[model samples]
Target: MARVDAAWYVTAGWALDLFQGRQTRDHDDIEIAVPAHGFPDVRRALSEFELYAIEDGLAHPLTPETLAISHQTWVREPATGLWRLDVLREPWDGNTWIFRRDSRIRLPRTRVIAYTEDGIPYAHPEIALLYKAKAVREKDEDDFAAVLPLLGPSRRNWLAKALTLVHPDHRWLEALRAGSTDTAAR
Candidate 1:
């Protein structure tokens, strides 16, 4: 794996684990978020790996135009056909995190991301949960359950507001409100 001196943060399930300070479960592959404009740096860093643009169940060699067509790119080792990494391209304004679903919702990169003991940056739990809101798969639900009890008031509040703005009637909003009440009770 090549390392780039660019802004990138671990996301998805692994991000939840990073916030909890431990790996809660097995992960199939690692997912990372990189600025849409900075993807070229990532590509250069991982030049040894074969990058494939994945969209609508199709995978093809990633080209400069691929960024405009797909938000995700999967990298693999050509020799062994082993998946190496999953890259998620995200909209950003310098050091700010822009919500893909709603560009109006933006936060400073510092607020939406945190660094591990080893200096690897990972998405904040609240931000990760916001992304998980759309899928609600068993794994996503499990991740929410695990991290909900651990969230502080600020994180819970931010996530609640974000959900309201983007999803409105999302069930997680109710759950987050309930969790807030529970936290207050404790």
Candidate 2:
């Protein structure tokens, strides 16, 4: 089996694993995200696994830094076209750290969760979603839909705070509050 990163489980992936439970069905491809400087380390660490890089850059760019160092992973899929393995990156400088996430966060360690097509370790489900949300694209929205219900109250709060910074004008926030209203029934 391939090695995997087990530490980075975000609420989304955790929710997917909880709600979907060990996917019996085959997935197109798995996705993961890591800080940019860490990408080379991850790539070097996973050298034994089948590695293919995507030039088109399908995943959402996490930041301007992510754009500067755009990357995507491609694993061969016999029927579903090329499956994407994306890694989202954000710049880190302890002096000017302006990220909006809560302080209790931890960067996950690399571990073996599942193997890739060529037997490289893929990232865990929760880690995948955490990274996926960083991109915040249409597909990521679909991902949120599939996994949002799985998030617990605390994680949801974290997600809300994070997105509030990322998308200050986000309509979903209003919709969410409306959904919570008892008066919506009237």
Candidate 3:
């Protein structure tokens, strides 16, 4: 593992696995996000790894100015030619964390990141679900179902609110709302 001098957290489906303490399903790759500003440091730390920007599902070597835009990058070891992890750049600031896709959705930095007992940091369930909600795939749906039971009232409510803001007609809203009502009943 390379040392990165930046703030990063496990996000997306892998984050749910971290929260659940086990792998709920197969993941093609692991995703870790760094605050947009901190990526330069991460890039410096991972200088040994080949970096490719993923656009339209294809990987291209990053351009000199590509880092200015927010996107996911594929890290590979040039010597081994083996694809490695993904580094997602997210919108963040000193006090607040903003959803990269939706600026309207924001939360305090403290509310977005949670640490495991082992000190590994991961995105809160709501943050993970919000990202997954952008394009609801089968695995995304499964992740939501598996984590719904584990989410408490506040987390469910936060996800529900964020989904409504970013994806007003999202199918998951029905389940999220129902889950909240159910959580309150119990």
Candidate 4:
């Protein structure tokens, strides 16, 4: 966690929800991602809330000592102990975003994030779908189905290329290449 400030964009299923202008599915927790070096700024900005580091599926106090190793952090609502935020510290270069699992996959930050009409930033649905391709849970597949035809050809091509780099034999490649892209939906 560094002191520098950076943008934190909504990610995963919730990001798809934001893009669709509604909550499309029930999510275990909402997630956001910031450049890894900018996490301390997030901690300082959200200091009023309690934060914890997840270790082996357990929540531990998020302190300076744990910051280096904690790629993900949970913001817990004090009174209810209910977690409300999941923060992912992602690797980023000047104007470029790199996939943490495979640095070979990179994109301009502009293409990685898109904003809603109300100005909330979110990960592109195709990028979210790419992440989900790693482990296609029932919910992930549902999100894919919901967002597939909404993608433009460029978005579909980008995601298909990314999947090839990370998970060459990923099952979703077939569907992404199925020519379902609809420019009107984008």
Highest TM-score scorer: 1
- Local accuracy of candidate 2 as per-residue lDDT tens digits, 1-186: 124332211223432443455543334444554444555555555554444544464543234453454545433344554543534333333322123243334333432134434433444443444445555665555555555555565555554555565555554444333333122221
- Show pairs that collide, candidate 4: none
The local distance difference test score of each candidate is 0.86, 0.43, 0.83, 0.83
Q: Write candidate 3's Cα lDDT for 1-186 as tens digits.
A: 347767788888889999999988988988998887888888888898999988778888887566554388889999999988899988886768888888988888889889889888899988998898888787887888889989887888898898888889888777787773232211
Residue ranges of candidate 4 with Cα displaced over 4 Å? 1-5, 181-186
Cand. 4 Cα-lDDT: 0.83
TM-scores for candidates 1 onward, in order:
0.93, 0.47, 0.91, 0.90
Model 2: runs farther than 4 Å from truth? 1-15, 18-27, 48-68, 71-84, 89-142, 175-186
With candidate 3 superimposed using the best TM-score fit, by how many Å does residue 34's alpha carbon deviate from the native?
0.5
lDDT, model 2, position 92: 33
By lDDT, the better pick of 1 and 3 is 1
Considering TM-score, where higher is better, how would the candidates rank from best to worst?
Answer: 1, 3, 4, 2
RMSD of 1: 3.2
Per residue, candidate 1 scores C-alpha lDDT tens digits across 1-186 of 246767889999999999899999999999999888888899999888899998887887898676578989999998999998999999999998899889988999899889989988999999999998886777887788889989887888899999999888877777687773332211
